[model samples]
Target: MANIKIVLADTDDKYLMPLERKFIDGLEDKADLIVITDPDYLKEYFSEPQRVDILIINEELYDAELERHNIASVFILTEQELLNNNTGDAEANRIYKYTSVKEIYAEIIGKSSARSETLNTKEETKILMMYSPIGGIGKTTVSAALCEALAKYQKKVLLIGIDSLQTIGSVIPQLPFMESGTEKLLIEKSEYVYEAVKTKIINRTFDLLPPFHLSLPSLNIKGEDYINLINGIRDSKDYDYVIVDGATGFTEDLSRLMGVADHTIILAGQDKNAVYKLDCLLRNIDCSDNDRFVFVCNKYRNNRENFLANGYMTNFCRVSEYIELWTENSASEEGVLTNNRSIQKLALMFI
Candidate 1:
């Protein structure tokens, strides 16, 4: 578990005093704050590689220092200032832009309900599924990144790898496991689904459930069987998020998982085949009215513009905001996730 690092940049010492105190008071032991007014030291702060989670910047200092640093930042202003500027439009997701010191405290505590839920009520682990039809995109990457993000505020998050072949490189940088298999659980056929479902939980929160032997050509599981397994985990009242890294294409198992999912995120690569597959999958899915769904475009390039112009999406999830982060000059060379900075920023976006 890493501590929440915050950078506070303001020119006035009087304004900076209360903001620093409020931040420390809000998060207590959970956060660390660095106050800076010198523009020269801005590069020095970010150059250390210890990515700051949130940057609380005054409106006056925002434009000068905001030169595309790798961090999740929020403009710190007075309540009157936020309303005057109408800063809420800049907020990408569930995060709220705070106007006052008190509001900042509320944002930190409000979003962090997973810990409080355990103390007050029987916590129910909500399962989230990240699924898509095509491969070589960012389904697996998004799943892993979402897990990393959710783990920021919530202490308990499990990223399960249930794809057919096996998922090895997504969560963290690692050497391939020679015999990663979910076959043992299949063979056990236990009435206790927990025993079967729970395996290889790494980092602080993520749990990895290995797939059947990768060497094998095919792997299959019934739709009902997957639902039962997920239900058993949900019944435990332990984790906050049960994120499923699904297999490519629409399978019975995938449908079962998606059907039960509270929120589903579909990743579409900027490719013609991927678009076609996404269209077919959306048409086939029998989703309920209340289910939350979203579309994320990965490896975005000129093809994305073409896809949007063609009006690709047919049903479910909004495609208004396409997420494209990885750049070609990145270390991965394949335009996939290669750096921790992008990974950390992505983690914050989902969190």
Candidate 2:
């Protein structure tokens, strides 16, 4: 019921004038709207904490200071809905530069109200880890699909790829190849891990920290560092869910990741070696006291008989779900899960 103070910072008159007119016409009595067309003045205005209810600025002008400001909600204005991996804020919501003024008003008001509600009643963020003991089984595909499906439901999602090879770039080509992301967070003490990850998001589907560009068999990230990163992301409160795509095998890094994960999706295929390695992984890793462990059989070919006869499912304590994406052509199709209702249904279990 209180008056909301909103700030619109951008230099383009062609884009700014229309939005300014609409804000005054629609919210004259309800809010105070301040429009700044200069980047320097905007930066100076946000140098200190301001009592802003909502702050909308162009993506090019965004910085950590804007985030440091005590604003109820922040939205980045961009040419496209999907932000580039380098310049966008993963934590903050975004609006298209060419959208209708009514749509802009609705977005600002809706998100500001939601922010107030969230602040008043804090909710837990769900953390899901997609892991496999062996590689080359469509693990990255399933992880990307799950994130996309979750986003389709309007849930804020963050996806972190900890694999040494950095397969997420291939899975989601829209994402930029960052030379250092999670590793930068680890090595540098000045940057915040949550803020760093927020800037590397792609398509609003998920916030991602692309894997380090390392050809080594193992990553330089320590167990404590990995745990700290996860804890930082969980505590950020920017996302509704955090999805991690972990490396294969039972390494210390994988163990630490699973240890903090709320739900662990153990991916396997119909291959005998894959099943055997998965059984070995189950025995070696300590997941007995975790929150939840789900076994997902990817590329399933109606091999229920083979799965049961080979006693593959019996090796694990429980099999939470199975996915049937067995076609040779299905793997090549982009946005397969986003367009497929059946696949989206299977992905909803993570939520």
Candidate 3:
């Protein structure tokens, strides 16, 4: 528990004493309760805004005093204020108001815990999506290998393979897993997507939700569906990160995937055709003008040295990172390319 410094703003010492006691009792030693007996004390503390994480206000301070002070603060409100006022919008990420002391404590504690968890790590939960053109270019291999490398950090990770391709079973067979199926969580209808995913989550070092046994390719997913799903998972209080293994090439779904991604790693290999398609895909993107699309040269051999050196293609695509790994089965638990140091550098693009 973090020691939270709080400022209580209310009139009348008799009423203030019980509320202060209730707030302190409700917090359970998680806060250093500082009761401001006088409005002057509120002014004194407001001068040093750094001291308080939360402020409790009564009916008395709602009007001109609140406007005059104009302190940017998290607020705790009485039951009447919470029941009466419906002005606050959920869209705006500010001025969280709690009705009771217990509710206030929970919100502060939960937020504080989340902040602490983020501070303790170099890599936190990242919602990442991998895309490419044509399946032979090793999107599955890259996704699986990346998941393996992510698992090495001992953080909870989730890998969800969008059911555009039905061959995910053949991709990674080493682990005991299940499919969320295109039936439950369609990329078009964002409703109940998380619940569908939650059921199919194969709990392990990294949980995977592969495609279902049945075919449902006609599911026309929209841009909004992808947006909602990505936002839901990103805002989800659980898991350190999310990895989306999407189909090769640009569809509405893929465009939505790239749009919400913190970083998109495009996998390229020795095949000239695959590299050309990847180049076209990278060039066509409208997201970040900066280095958002990381070009990863995967599964390159000695024969592909000239391919990496091709200055025109490199300059056109702005190829930033390269991962040259020997062609192995790359699906087996121990045989996969997660141990390779070069791929670790590529993984840093998401980290």
Candidate 4:
């Protein structure tokens, strides 16, 4: 068995001290252990990358920084019975309070062993581009929903909005203004692009790189710049999925973005004009077997003609995987598509 490097972090003095002692005693000469009780020290420790084999942290202390480092095995310690009741998956490891040291040891060793076996098989980050030629097709809504759903499943996701109009701000209000400006960061050559992206991340769920805050008539971003930006994000290894919400319409920049993506999700509607536009867009782009493409019919209504329209879409699009997102009135009112069960289920399939 490989020796593990473990970090036990918790805030409760009464609970943390005894648990630390027990862990040290149980794993003595078998592993390297570090105990952290102070919040400031814990934050400082995670500021940079640390080779932590296993992280046993309080549920309340879990943050985006932990997720960013790509810790392979994480076990959240909680006192709530409800939280501890659902801990089966590799990502959802949890330990209830007052558990015996032997039980804790078994859980840690089991998860750590599994982590070691697959350490060399880490999957490359997936870049998914969400685009539509037709406007008002709810592309942004679907993009945001996909990010949120992936995050909920413990997958780190980054949302990049390439639309010059900056519609993401309308959905997610009070977005922090980029002091350096998104345009400046992308256009200028810099070695710290990855670090710069880390600082702009919001709520630990996903990072948003919107268009220039200043209202310029048009952005000067070119196709190559967009490619470089996406490449930098992929190389950073900070996110499991990078979702680019491109502007509506088929442009050189959009085509290039799709070329770099591992998967492209094309959004369309049931209307004849939308279908015609989609067919035209498909003809322009060269989507081969290597690049996966999924067709989604947004705002779908249950009717005989609309159902046949979905069948017609497959004939021209040449994509086997097709999904329909029915119009949900509450999706707008809630301001979050994942709140709707159907949307959530659909989003989960993307990952």
The order by descending lDDT is 4, 2, 3, 1
Residue pair clashes in candidate 4: none
lDDT of 3 by residue, 1-351 (tens): 456566666766775676677666655666677776676766666654254455556544543334334333445444343322233622112223333333344434433433343223333447777777766767776776777766654446777777454565565665543443445465646565776566656765567765555443654544456567657766664666677777766777678677777677777765677666766775777534446766667766765554645756756555555666655653355345655656555554444
Model 2: lowest-lDDT 10 consecutive positions: 114-123
- Candidate 2: stretches off by over 4 Å: 1-122, 179-182, 189-191, 216-219, 286-291, 303-305, 312-315, 326-336, 339-342
Name the candidate, 3 or 4, with the larger TM-score value: 4
Compared with the true structure, what per-residue lDDT tens digits does model 2 show for residues 37-156?
Answer: 888888788776688877888878878766676776778888885532234455577777775565566556545655554223335888888888877887888888887767655567
Q: After superposition, how far is residue 323 of candidate 2 from its true place, in Å?
A: 1.1
Regions of candidate 4 where Cα sits further than 4 Å from its true position? 1-122, 180-182, 215-219, 288-291, 307-312, 318-329, 332-334, 339-350
Over 4 Å off in model 1, which ranges?
1-107, 110-122, 175-182, 196-200, 215-224, 286-290, 302-304, 312-317, 325-351
User: Please, what is the TM-score per model?
Assistant: 0.58, 0.59, 0.58, 0.62
lDDT of 4 at 132: 88
State the lDDT at 255 in candidate 3.
Answer: 81
lDDT by residue (129-151, candidate 4, tens digit) is 89888888888878887787666
Give me the displacement of residue 91 in model 4, in angstroms: 12
lDDT (tens digit, per residue) of candidate 1 on 262-293: 77777775567767777777688754343366
lDDT per model, in order?
A: 0.58, 0.68, 0.58, 0.69
TM-score winner: 4
Per model, state how many residue pairs clash: 1, 1, 5, 0
Superposed by TM-score, candidate 3 places the C-alpha of residue 20 at a distance from the truth, in angstroms, of 42
Backbone steric clashes in candidate 2, count: 1
